[model samples]
Target chain A: MNTLVLTRNDLSVIVQAFGRDALMDEVLAQLRIALREYDPSRTQSLRRQGFVYEKPRLGVLEWMPVMRVSRQVVIKVVAYNPGNPDDVGLPTIVSTISVYDPATGHLVALLDGILLTALRTGAASAVATQILARPGSSIVGIIGCGAQAVTQLHALSRVMQIQEVLFFDTDPSAVASFPRRTAFLGLSMKSAPPNVVARASDVLCTATSVEVGKGPVFEDSDLKPWIHVNAVGSDLPGKIEVPLSLLKRSLVCPDFLEQALIEGESQQLDASEVGPSLSDLVKRQQDFEAYRSRPTVFDSTGYALEDMVATEIVLKHARALGLGRELAIENILADPRNPYGPLDVQASRPAQDRALP
Target chain B: MNTLVLTRNDLSVIVQAFGRDALMDEVLAQLRIALREYDPSRTQSLRRQGFVYEKPRLGVLEWMPVMRVSRQVVIKVVAYNPGNPDDVGLPTIVSTISVYDPATGHLVALLDGILLTALRTGAASAVATQILARPGSSIVGIIGCGAQAVTQLHALSRVMQIQEVLFFDTDPSAVASFPRRTAFLGLSMKSAPPNVVARASDVLCTATSVEVGKGPVFEDSDLKPWIHVNAVGSDLPGKIEVPLSLLKRSLVCPDFLEQALIEGESQQLDASEVGPSLSDLVKRQQDFEAYRSRPTVFDSTGYALEDMVATEIVLKHARALGLGRELAIENILADPRNPYGPLDVQASRPAQDRALP
Candidate 1:
């Protein structure tokens, strides 16, 4: 059987054709449905397994695998190289998602996970913001105007009436380019310092690439009492982006608690201080109504379930538009017992002519 | 950047051109070198992580990732479906190997892992047999003549001067087709019962797909005193091919100790009863010479290092022969900070034309 291969261009075509707002809306809706109907016994999502190395310029390669029982398995292999942007002019994260047939273990599709990852992460934050942020929350504050900041703005715009964006970044070029990169959104944008952005908005997103052990992008003093924070950049140990003092008092909900405790902003707080998961909030919105009136934090470490939902939406659109290449990557043998059946043995020379090296 | 995609057809072309014996010989040699020079600090090979489900079918999908410090990362995603052979007309295991550039987290190559897995597994057994099997061994016996049996015989033939082969399988068709499938080897072959095959051999291989709870393909009664058996089929907990009684009296060397304790044949024995790992045996051959004169078992659980070596060999040959397709799978953006730069925005409709559903 042939596996459908979707390149980055194909994914871009999907975004251009379907429109980012519609796509993120579908992702948000599907994520809510997936969370609402999720049964832990049926859907198995594990913490990522990978290697972190310092020699090859401080990077990590991880594999996130999630299985929907009797359905399909989605595995996303992602690499995070902190120095890629300056050293090699590449994004900090590069990834690919592979989907497999559960019954026969056949690879069904392979898609570019770079854009998918950013899109899904944005949708995850939107899911949390819609549930926790106050109604009619319009002003959005963004720290770290990098690649992730655009999607964070776009996704929140889809869920909230994001009319004005106040942003800050350590890099002057990223700060200058933010308005141009997000010009299509047509929202009034302003470049400001961290503390200025922190105190002026009702919903804030921290997506900075702050150096390890030097975080808490802004202090907890000059913030709105009812502002909701989406802490997005603390994906590695010792790399938190939010202040601990802010998290201790707020309703800190993590996307995946087991993973967030190790990598997300929740790492700074004790397990007992952390509130319910995003899924828990989605399942019982009425139970968490009290947290909307207070400061809240959504610590997102990125879960495999988000990738699964994102991949499903991408594949659905790709298949409908007929926008991928189908390649016979695996050897589907006529006789399952003979692996050698696929060899082009006619081209082989005699055994006597070939000797061991 | 482009990723070199090697399909099963491409891999078959490599095997057909390089010759199976020569390829197996090179794999065996490289495996020896890799094991001898292995340092846990530099090469981080983790235990596999995935899911096993028994829903529509009984199957497992696992990702095995290994990273060589300052070098590349190799991940092999494999699926094991016990009902594949009879129910779906596919191999019991299907897999794909992806090689990533550690410096930038760029995927350099994607290769079909069906034949690669079988070849590397056989090479792993040969590495152990060459060190622990008797010198100048001629008679070879094989139990459970399935897909893995062919490679086991081929790899052993590369290390020993085999003149005759005695094989047995509960499946009559597998027993009847064994000789024809391995006709190119030109060795005399006979089909016999499991006990008869076990009693008349200097080296033996057990590659069966026995049920999880129903195992011990052959009893320990009529075996030769100095026979060395490569147990290649016991890869899951409580799924052993060799008898526990036999393992207790013999020196059992596992490919990976920690993994074997959970999934390999070494699970039948206590921690102290098991011998050193295969790498340990390669690193200190002199220390294990005494076991060559007695009954010994090589518990093969299949490690990621083996897959890494196998992938390197295949990529080297593929590069030299120009046998695989190079596709631009990932977006190498000019501006590292703009993920949306690749979108065909000119083709997109106006915002008012596309609204959220």
Candidate 2:
């Protein structure tokens, strides 16, 4: 038995069989298990991953490595483009997810990291919303509508209740037909400025691929106190989505402190302004539901544990539903043809003195 | 239509349908295309990747970001076990593969990456050997026969003609059973010391997970004239195999010079000995085959290009047979609902702002 391969169709079937509710529950459940089991202080290193753009002269490449420890996984996403992004019709944000196995040699898996960035980014927000958002949060304000914004909506719908959603893209038109594509959700869509939805919605998500020194997307000063924000879009070596001043007023929560301190809105904050990680809040004796009392914030700089959480979710369910294919490509010589455990070695005899043919 | 998921069973079927000979031929064809199209010098730093392994008080975790630039697909593999290997009698290598369509920030597919390592490793060696090794030359010797060793042999059988096979493992049983395991190849097998096998084979493969400062496995005197050794087992930071003196004798070649210089057998060499990389030699048209005359050697550290090669191979075969699963995981809002047009992202004719119901 080996790793099961799940294609899009197989995954679709798995999702249909499990139902969206169960899949989100499992993803969150795995995230908690991974978070509780991991501690950054003990792990060895991050995973090495790559991205191949295969574009003409712009064969851009990105190699990223990450580490997951202490209730979260830390990632360093880099872009490798010899040709400027302006020259080619491509975004320069190249990245990878470095996942750590909480046990053993910590030599767990080295997966396709770029995918981790998308899933974990969305999953982390979903996890936080599960704990902090209002029980029946149906309306969401998606700020900086882009690729990550789509994942935010998908993963959020997986875990929380989304009845109506509002979107705000700089171009305004990207979200024009959001309803037609997401009609499966049966939720009506509204288009508005970031502030309009940020003020009206119970949950707010901001995912913008902004460059460093670029202007902030959402003004923290304007956010309604009860609105739970999922800050995902601004994920680069040096980029920010929500401003520092807004972060100062909110009881900040992050996936990992290290990532937030550098890449998230936390990067712009002084030491005292930074908040506790998601694990810290989740583990506390206080009611996790009380996150809105003090105007809580989730400054997510996506981490590796989210990938672990997502992978475990996929693997566990795939196994149960038989969603994936098992490969013999990594075949070990463990056949019953010979007594000595398939390699044809005699376990009963000295390992060094076997006769050759 | 999206990434087609190929389970080992699917992959096995694909391979069988194509025939082993044809699959190897396909891999060879892919290698040729990869080489012809590859210009490592042109790829940017984003394409270069590594991982972060941290230390925590409770357990160990590794952050692995495995990415490929040619594909724009990144995956993060996570394996977590506090003290798993000895406690559970398991191979402490658990992982997942996440495929993404980065342009739209979509998670195309998430596959189990454990098998990916083995398949990619074999394909990598095959790619290197196909371009570097002389065709019609065989007679092989393998060191450290373990999980990876099996695939190496299978992939190798497809490319070359092996007349005599040699095995030398510290574990005597591993050495003795070589004949039967390789019976399908109809090659000669024997159990001998490292030096003896080093002297016997034309292509010497050092795949043991040995490191520097650990005594060398073989001496320079043990090497045969003109032997092409593929040293792949040493890939991480400090892991290394092969005697530095023998490596020095050969015109060193690496799948990627930048990686091998730091992670390959060359690690044993001081800063002074590091010279031009594998591509350098290729560009110079140096005689890599003159083993006795020049002592040609390839420090076979694997590269990401090989994964791109293997992926292309799998995709080609899967399409030919219509055997893999299709996906809709990526949210590419194409003009039409199909044919992504080679990673093209045309801004949809501006979204019509419509309120969702």
Candidate 3:
């Protein structure tokens, strides 16, 4: 009943308490295991419908269900309405996660998924990099410098010996200071043009949501063999960040094939070209050596189950440190003695009187 | 910048301040306006593949995306794994809501959808009944007296004149005390058989989450030709209470057809038998009149846009009455005054250490 409400500071506390590297390292571990728990047969794709009375003539709703067996968590998130990115001055997508105790079905914790989303997305890229990238790939190119960009560097640093970072944003000045932060991480950073970063960096990460529906970011000519590409930007219908020709030529692997086909860069490519899931990689993992020889595409449109995994990790860490503010948002019936009756609210009279009578 | 965290007590303050009737009226108004803003061309299901990671061989991740309009809010709620009912003695679904300020692309509020889900769900049912139910019809028959049943009555009391309510729950004792709470609304209550209550009441509501796979509760033969059966439980796959035969016989109108088809009692019958959407009732303006002559079915499967409406209402009222608690659960950059690049925790080490360490 005492659910801890972790503040933004708590997340920062955890980041500082456990080095960011250690956090991303653990996050990837948990996510990898979470991926293992996915059983296509057991999962459910929920339905949604709403009333639409105007132009465009459609009301919408969505339901997604996921399970992380190793972590013992199941996650579902519904993003409803034709939420516009321009209207909110933020990502159109809004999310929240419910962490439950699988052993007892007890509702455990509820956390903000926006940050979790940015973290897990970056962590997923780091995960793919850990499995596919050359071990000492110290130089990295981050094509987008938005919210997920910061986390990408944070998570990647946790897994690889990230000695240098190259940053690019449409507004070059927006990310001119990337080098300053890397200095604290004991790494140097530079501002580079798209080609310079893509051509010189050992690993490439695309984290732009704006790239959706425009065109591919890189052509086959831009990518280097053995250099891994982590595409985390576009994750919706008609969204693709990497060109089909580039994807076809690369040793492609996706977080989930069904997903990549619908949202990832693979959405545009022939189904045969998109490659297998991380599960496939785990199964035929012996070919890990082959990753070094081929140009690799790590298409990561984030997974919601990762939020649950990250939530469990956050809860576990928060509980261990005894961090978080506890507040009761759900009204617990005052008269627990009357199990079948309504919750009493007489105390609310004072507020009403102060405002009205 | 200030998000008030409204606890159950706060919710009580909310109701007391606005008065239950006022709240119901406001919710209905909001629901109508919400329906007016939906646009189908703007919404394609949020890509589910990206968020779900099927367990290695067992489960999958689910996140649904539903969009409304250009100026309105679109939301995604993650209702992770539902707790096992018997083992946990709790509702299986736990969820949260996120409201986006699309103009600035900023995530404005991360809310407790668990609370809003129940509130909005009950509010939505009341809207349906207010517009669809017969005039002056008060006495009610509730098929299953679960958690939603209590809210069902509370919501109806605000919209209709009722003097009595009869409930039928598997656990007889569960409904034994059901009548007392509604006593304040000038109503008496009791436990009665489906046939008995179905015959006596002018308006009947079936609220059991249990369905046909489990077995039907009442046949079409049990319904009074004049009764309005508000089916609120058959909203998920594998959950149905009203028999398909009842659906065939009645003038059925659904909150959302696509949803009811897969989750409602309509699922038991072929898709052909399910009637038009509730909007169609609004469209043709005939459903309300036709129902007066025969048993009417308001197939109520919850919708996300309604949640958006409810959230918008609760939040508007919550802010006006100073309810909700502020949560500092979002990200905090090191330099709050002038944040740049990835957060440098080291730069803010002094501040954090001063606070804790």
Candidate 4:
């Protein structure tokens, strides 16, 4: 059997062929179904396992695995190097995702994970915002205008009637380029200070790469009463973007509770203080309608289930468009009992005289 | 940067260029150095994490990750399906190994892991046999003549002056094809019952695919007093190959103590009954020389360190021969700050008019 290999270019073709808005809509709909129907007995997603190193540069390499019982297994191998952009002209994160057949253990497909990760994260936040944000929420605030900010705005635009965007960043160039990068969304964009962005918005997103222990990106005093915040930047132990004081007053729901406590904004609060999980909110949206009148937070640390959903979307599009190469990467041996069968075939040895090096 | 991709065919070319015996010697030498110089502070090899499923078929998919502080990280994703050979004519285990750069998280190379896994397991046992087996041991016994037995006999031939081979398996075809598959080694081969193979041997290797909770592949009374057994097949809970009575009387050294205690022959013995680790034996060979006078067990459940060493050898050979293909699998964006830069380039959009789907 051959494994389908998709490159970054192929993924771009997929996104362009199927309009971005349409793809986001499909992802949002699928994610809602996956979250609403999640059964602990059928789906298994373990916390990521990897190493955090401090030499050569500060970085982490992690493996996130999620298995759908009797169906398939999807795993993403990601590397986060904080110094990649300035030092080596590379993105801060790089990753690859692989899908395997549960019964045969055959690799079905391998896809580039850079764009998939960003898109799925954006969709996850959109799901949260749809359930927790006020129905009339229109003005969106974005802090730390980096790569993630583009998808955050795009995915929210798909779910909400976003009219204007207020954004801020410490880097002048990033603030200047934000409008051009997301001009396709056709929304009014303004570059403002952090406090101004926080206070004049119905919803806010914090996606900064702030140093550990350096933040709660904006103070709680500078926020509106019904603002829904998608806390996207606090993925490391001491790195937080939303203030603990703000989380205490708000109804904080985490994407994955156990993982969020270790690395997300929920790390600031005790387990008892946190609200229901995103899955719970997804299952029972009507039960939490009262939270739309107060402050709310969706703490996302990125889950493997989102990756699995995104992979399904990408592979479906790739298959329809025939946009990847099929390679015989594994040895599907002619004789299953002998691993040396391939070597013997290569040397053209007779069965009785077969020899391995 | 491009990632070098090696398929099964490319790996076959590499093995044919450098003789298998020469390669095993190199692997054995590097493994000894890596084990002797291993320091917990510099190297981190976590226990593997994955899922074990029993629907459609009984199988497991696991990820083994090991890091050499500040240098590199090697990860192996393996799938073990016991029913593959009979149901689909595929090998029982299929896997792929990936190497990542620590500084940039760039995937340096991806290689086929089927043959590499077998070679490394056999070489690990050879390292143990050289340390614990009696020097004049010329007779070798192999229980369960499957794919692993070929490499087991070949690797032992490189380390010992073996004159005869006695092997047995429940499957008659496996027993019939053993000598032809190992024709290169040119050793005397005989097929016998389990007790006979266990009795007339100086060193025994048990690599059976025994069912869970139905083990002790051979009886304790049918063995030599000073024989060293390389227990290779007991990698899951409730699955053991060597009898508990034999393990109680032997000096049992595990390849990795923590992992062995969970899935290897060491699972049958208490923590207090286990001897020093393989790394300990490699570091202080003279201190454990007395083990050669009694029965010893090398509980080999496999480790990531062996895979790391084997990958280094294969890559060195591939580079020297200028083999394998290089593909640009990742998106190294022209503008590091913008994830949509590639899409803009693909669509020929000017920088100011850049838009993502």
Candidate 5:
């Protein structure tokens, strides 16, 4: 059978064709459907939800998350190595996406998930920023300027008009290099300390690689009223970007309650201590005015549904534009009943050349 | 940056170069390591083991099993559609394997898992047969002659000196078509009923796609004394190949107890009723002769470790032979800090055509 292989360059072309606004809108729509369809009760059961494996070694930690979205199935295999960029000059986190036909278990497409992950993650935050951030919010504060920071700014721009950005990073090189890369966005950018960014902005985002059990990125003493916080970095258990005091005091909303309870900033607090989920906000089940009245935190742990949405959109666009090439990766036998048909083709050769024949 | 795509044909060449005995030996060695490394207590944790997702729709049931083995990660996305062969003329079960580098999260290879799966599965049973099957057993009885049956014979041939084969299938077409495939094996063969095969054989293997909750394929009374049975078909929760009476009487050894409790023939009985695991047998922790004196059943449900072993071997062989084509599926930037390097290449295009400038 034919397996369509889409390169990162091919996906970039597709992204260019659709534009970021259209891509963001499509994923935003999928997020709504995903929120509605996601069953928290079925998480442990193998029948509906896919399984995840995390293999941690001395130098590397690998994560494999698999999920089935309607007729399509997706498996993402990723590795996170802290030493990659410094030692190997590779991205700290890299991944691949494989999409399959759920009916016959045939792999339909293979995609580069690194860029897709950044884009989809940015879109998820943008969705929250649209629903939770204050009206006419002009200034945005961003902590941790990495590859994700670029998309975060671009995605937020699709939903809200921002005139300036206050960004900070521990790495001075990353801090110095941000403007030349983001100068194309045409927004006035300020390099600020974490506390200054937290105090001056109407909206804040924390996306750091700070170790768990460490203090929050910014001190809670910097008072900022009605400032919406998108806690993106605190996705692993014990990794908290915002202080527990701030989280406990604010109106907290998680992307997904079950995941946030384990991986997001909300993991710092008890399940009962947190407020409604982002689904509740997206569905208009929460009191928006009341939630916005106090400081609000959107605990954004990356979700599988977002990846499913991104993969689907990418595959759809690639197919429409005839962008990907087919590889002979699946062996579809001429006779469906006989699995050994392929072996027979090679069997005509001499026995000494092959062991099977 | 490069994903080495190994086609089924390329894998076949690698398989030919390596030879089955060498391949089987390497996998058997890996199995020993797997048994030693597998910790059943960590089944639920994301650190050591991955989770599994089972999506069962009205028309299809899809399974996505992800696993991380040391520094190499693998995701097998597969679908099981009963109507595939008849409706679409595709294999009833189709799948793909994606391998990733845990250090950089870069996808290293994409492999056709259909053939690999068959080979690994056969090797698993062969391992069990070597450990549990009676000494000097010459005749092998195989039910449900399909793609797996060929591997069953081939895998067993490596470990035993087979004199004759008794095979049967409910589908007469499969029964009629077996000799052409078996002609390569050059083994004496006979067509017989399930009862006749069971009574005449020293070893038996059942690999049928029989419906769940159906009556057993053969009566408990038909089984020969000290027979070693490889129940390869009953992997689902309710699917069973051998009678419950036979299972109770036999010394049932499962590949993995937790998985076997849910998906193997042992699922028919309680957890307490099942005997030692295949790991226990592979490690020789259980009493061998005493268990072998009774009816011995290898409850083979397949495992993630077997897939890991098969994938590593395939990738190694393919690399050694230079048998795969490289695809630019991952964007590894020249400057590891700049993620927008690729977007700049296509930035000169129009705004309506694309967004990010």
Candidate 6:
């Protein structure tokens, strides 16, 4: 069987074909469908997550998260090697996605997961902003001007009137470069400190690239009431981007409740502190503005549904354009009864050659 | 940057180049190293198993089992579609093996897991037989004669001296065709019922193709004293091939304790009743003849390391011969800082074409 191999360049082309607005619209629609078909009781059977291995005893660990959404089966294998950038000039987070045919257990596509991850995550934050942020939200503050920062602006712009964006990064170079990188969006930008961004924005998005046990970007005193926070970067155990004091006083909505309780910023607080998840929010449309008296947190630990949707988007576009290269990775046996028939043919080749000689 | 895609033809050739004895030897050596590197305390972190998705509401669910052995990470995706054979003429169990480089999170190879699974599983049973069975065992009895049946005999022959063989299957045609298919092995064969085969053999292997909750092939009364039973078929939550009474009477050894407890025949009995795992057996030197008075059951639910080792064997032979094709699936970015540079090129190409027009 043939498997479509979509490289990073291919995905980039696909994402560009459909602009950020259309891509976010497709992702949001897929997320809705994902939530509608999801049975909360089957969550246990739906996904599995674990640390695969640790290199050098105490160094970074590779994590594998596998999940199935309806007919789509996805396994995202990512390595969180802290030393990759310094050692090999590769990104700290490297991932490969395997998409399978659930009916036949055949791998239909192998995707570059690093870019897909960023887009899906940005879209998830956009979804949360659409559902949880107060009406007419305009000004947006973004902390951590890294790879994810551009996507966050691109996605959030599709959902909200992002007329002005404030960028804050500890690295002065990152702060200096954010404006030029995002200049194509035609949105005015200002470089501000963390506290200034926190106090002056209608919505706050934290996508900091911090090590485990890093300091919180801002204290509880800095956050403004009614300003929604998309805590996108704290996705592993011991990784905190938001303070516990702020989370305790806010209506925290997780992307997926179980995952956020473990890997999201809500991991720091008690279970009771976290409110309904994004799935729950999509399932039951609540008057989100009623609970906007305090800061809201969409604890954005990336979900498998978002990845599957983004992958489906890429696969659909690739197949439509006939763009991806076909790899003969899987074998289709002619006869099931003689599974070893191929091996016998190889084993007998030498005898045949010798006989001919 | 390049992943070697090994098709069934490639794997068949590789396995033939290595032969059964060398293949089994390599698998056994890898098993030993796997057990040595395995920390019983870290069992929870080393392996993750879960159902991927279910079709037709409650029908067969695709299962994914992932594990890490040192720097190598492997994920085996198996789809168990009950309606496959009649509906689509496909095997009930369709599997694919994905091997990744943990350090770089790069996929090194994608091997056809269907054949690899059979070979690895058969090798696992053979490894257990070599460790647990009596030294002078000769006669072999196989309960089922399907796809796995051939490999069981092939793997066992490499580890033991089989002067005579007995085959038993409910399907008369399967029983009739076993000898001709395995005629290369040049072993005397006997067609017998399950009870007769159970009572007469020194090594009794139950590789039956039975549905979940089906009747057991044989009971405790049918077992010969000191006969080692390689229970290789039952590997799901509700599936059973061996009688619990027989399991209760035998010293059951699981391939992996936690997995066997969930998917092996041990699922029928309490966790306390299951004896030492095969890893434990491989880790320690045990006196086999001392415990030969009672029946021994090697509960093989299949482990990820076996697949990795078997893949490594295939990969080593394939790489040495340069037999597999490379797929350009992932792109290594020239500048890590400019993650979106590829998209910019795609976006600018259209504008450049427009300017020329």
Q: State fnat for each of the candidate structures.
A: 0.53, 0.11, 0.16, 0.43, 0.51, 0.33
DockQ of each: 0.57, 0.10, 0.23, 0.41, 0.44, 0.33
Off by over 4 Å in 1: A342-354, B342-354
* lDDT digits (tens) for residues B160-220 of candidate 6: 8888999898878678878876765668899988888888888888887676778588766
Better of 1 and 3 by TM-score: 1
Q: Scored by CA lDDT, what does every candidate get?
A: 0.86, 0.54, 0.60, 0.84, 0.71, 0.71
Per-residue CA lDDT of model 5 for B150-179, tens digit only, reads 777777877788899999988897788777
Instruction: Please estimate how well model 4 matches the true structure, expressed as its whole-model Cα lDDT.
Output: 0.84
lDDT tens readout by residue for model 2, B1-357: 354555546655654454444454555556556555556554332223433333442232332333333444544443433223235543334444445544433345444344344555665565455445655667787886644555566567666767777777665654555556555444567667888888876777776645335646666775556677777676555666777777665656666666676767767676456544444543443444343344555676655555545555665566777775564432222321111111212223122212111
Interface RMSD score of each model:
2.7, 10.9, 9.0, 5.0, 5.1, 6.5
Q: List the residue pairs that clash in candidate 6.
A: none
Writing each residue's lDDT as its tens digit, candidate 1 over B225-246 gives 8889999987678899898988
Q: What docking grade applies to model 5?
A: acceptable
DockQ of candidate 5 against the true complex: 0.44
TM-score of each: 0.97, 0.65, 0.80, 0.95, 0.88, 0.89
lDDT of 2 by residue, A1-357 (tens): 343344444555554565443555566666766665556564323332334354543332333333444433443334434232234433333343333334433322222333334555666788777777767777898876554565577678776667788888665445664545444445568898777877777888887655567757766555566677777754444677776666776777877777677667777787677666787766762556666544666888666556556655655565777664544322122331121123222212232321221
* Predicted model with the maximum DockQ: 1
Segments in model 4 whose C-alpha atoms lie over 4 Å from true places: A342-357, B342-357
TM-score (0 to 1) for chain B of model 4: 0.95
List model 4 lDDT by residue over A77-185, tens digit each: 8887777877898877787888988787778888777777778888999999999998899999999887778889988987788888999998897898888878767
lDDT of 3 by residue, A95-198 (tens): 44555443433335655555676678877887777778876788899886665676787778767777778878674534764555445455578878777878
Candidate 1: which pairs clash? none
* Cα lDDT of model 6 by residue, A1-357, tens digit: 777777666766766776544565677677677765667544332333645345542233343444453565676766665455446766555677877766776778887777677678888888888888878889999998866787788778767777789879887867877776676567889988898888877888998767677758876775667889998886567888888888887889987777777778988888887898787777775756576556788999777767777777778888987787776565456545445664554342222221100
